[model samples]
Target: MNSIGLLIEFNDGRVKEANFGMATAARGENRNLVALVADGPAEDAQAVLEAYGVARIVNIRSGNRSWDPARQAAAVAAAMQKLEIDSLIGLTSPSGRELLPRIAARLGAPLIMDCIDIDLEAHRVRTSQYSGKTIATIALTGSHFIYGMRANVVPALKEPAEAEIIDFSFDGYQDTGYEVIETRTDGSGAHYLAEADIIISGGRGLKRAENFKLLFDCARHMNASVGASRVAVDNGWVPYAMQVGQTGVKVNPKVYMAVGISGSVQHFAGMKTARMIIAINTDENAAIMANCDYFAVGDLFEILPELEKALAAAKRSKEVA
Candidate 1:
């Protein structure tokens, strides 16, 4: 069986739960599962990675570099060569957008991004196309291939295995020439959008910026992230970071709840990979209604508040129990 490598991501010294799904995707009966980790303590992730079938953890040294994608990619590629990894899988996030392609290009390997399914034995993978309207099956011929999967769509079922950590230093890897100045944040706490399992989005149907509270309130109660359509952002009802469309962030969450959104192809393009989509619109003939798994034709003002109240009541009941 071929060796499978999963690029594990960490946040502030902790493992990102999203990588478990990537592990699950790469798992096979006779395959060897290796985790490629950097920046964070790989030991901290041993238990969780083993729970999802990782067999080994390769901890790579960063060489005191400060936020360089080129350096990071070089280290990852070097690790792959050292481990003799035949295939690699990772989650599609901000870092992946830069790292995965570079690694693939450096290794001269075939690469697929935002994939929903992969069959390593067949050298084929499945991804969404035409704004999530259909699935495209792509075949590849290569000695090694890297796949970037959408978050939460693949179930990370537990199949335990013990993991051994291997310390590797890739100091020979130098930067490929991309440099950054500095980074800033507005503290919006919206970074989870790219990795969220559940998201609730609003559009022009929301009417006003203050009215976004309706969506935010529901999202908070449900532990779901909030998103906005291009229309909503253009109208100044929400920031561009919250926008979901062809021009906005592409998301593939488990459950996407679109409220007051008029289901345009551009917007659906961003969330077409969602496992389940529920739309709310006043028009029965709205484009969103046709594309959604389920929909309710009603005034969002009434439905949103009612949903929030019901969610709050449910949470209270669970707490009491």
Candidate 2:
């Protein structure tokens, strides 16, 4: 059996939910699942990784500098080499996007990013191309492979196993001149769309930028991230960072609620992977209506207030309970 390495990502010291999805994707008939935790407490992730059938965990210690992507990549590459792992899998998150390519470069292996499906034994994978217009299947021609999966697309399933932990420290690491002196948040105090489990997006139908507050208010109660369509961003209703489309951020939330969006192909390409899609638009003939699992036809100006009130009431009820 070929050993498949899963690069684990942690948020606030807990295993990110998406790692389990990567773990699930790495499991196969002739694969031995291994988890790699760099600069984090591997023990903290053991129980969950075991639940996902990860039999081995490697805790790589290079230093306490979590922001050093080069150092982390070196450590991970060394561990994979020492373990003789055939393939390395990780989420196509911001950090993963930064680190995985470095590791692949160091190892001289082929790497594929934003992959939706992987067949390790066959050395083939599938990914979306041309803004979700086509699905492309690619075959790897290297001895080692690296895959960066889109977050939240693969479902995490339970497959219990007794895990064995190994601690690895790399002493041959050298600085690459790049230093992350300080990290700061954008101060929005909201999750990025890629990492958010629930996302509510606005579009041109909102009429103006201030109208987005309606989405923000509802999102606040639901603990969801807010996004915008290209039209909304182009109209200056929101910043480009909040845009979700082919030209913006891709999201794979559990629930994607599109408000006022016309369901253009570009916007759909970004969020089509969401497990559930709900659209609210005044036009019943909107393109989103046909693609969404559920849709409501009405004025969002009226619907948002009632929805916010309902969500707030539900929160109060749950708190009291």
Candidate 3:
């Protein structure tokens, strides 16, 4: 029987929501499920991993507490080898993107990244190509495979399992060559744009920097992430980190709300894969109108405040109920 290993990621000492989706992709008949935690403790995550069909959790400790991608990848590869895991699955996150490839190179395994779906039984995976213009199914012929799943593409399904936690110490490579100088955050106060389920982005039509507060206020009430068009960033209305475009961050949110955006090709390339798109622009002939699922021609300044109030009221009502 083959075992599937899930590379669990953590943010602020808790499991990221996308790991559950990766666990869902790892599920199959006649296959054992294992979760691997490299950067943090695994005991607190055992219960949640169990709910996602993970029967065993491996906590990898390198003994040297340092941020070294090379060492961490070697440790993960070693753990997989010890457990005889035939497949390793992880999210296409910043850490996973850097870590998975190194592990693949170390283990000499066939690697696939940004996969939207995985068929464990058939050793096949589905990916979006040409900026989601087409879907491609690729077959893996190797006995061992490393796959990076796109965040939130696979909905997490609850499959209860009795899980056991194991501690694994790997002294394979212990060179703390890299030291962290500083960490920078986007400071959006919401979820990361790439990982958010819903996103609301502003563009040049927002006029000035202060107007971005409307976007932030509405985002807070919706529990969604905020993004900005390249024009908005270039005009100094928002930071470059908030930019969503071909040259900026690519997002795959469930719903992408474009406010006062003209939807240039570069901007569309980043968010075209969103499941649903809603556009609000003053021009009916705006390029975003044709590409979006829904659109409303209006002044965002007037519309946004009302939208924020309505969302806040609904949230308070839900909490009261």
Report the lDDT tens digits of candidate 1 across residue range 145-238: 9998887767778889999999988788655556766666687757568788889999988989999999989988888999999989999988
Which candidate do you rate higher for lDDT, 2 or 3? 2
Which of 2 and 3 is ahead in TM-score? 3
CA lDDT of each prediction against the hidden true structure:
0.86, 0.91, 0.88
lDDT by residue (263-302, candidate 3, tens digit) is: 9988987898899999999999999999989999999999
Q: Following a full C-alpha superposition, what root-mean-square deviation does model 3 have from the true structure?
A: 1.9
Tens-digit lDDT track for model 2 on 198-314?
Answer: 999999999998999999999999999999999999999899989999989999899999999999999998998888999999999999999999999999999999999999999
Q: Can you tell me which runs of candidate 3 are displaced by over 4 Å?
A: 174-190
Better of 1 and 2 by lDDT: 2
Where model 1 places Cα greater than 4 Å from the true spot, the runs are none
Would you list the rank order by TM-score, best first? 1, 3, 2
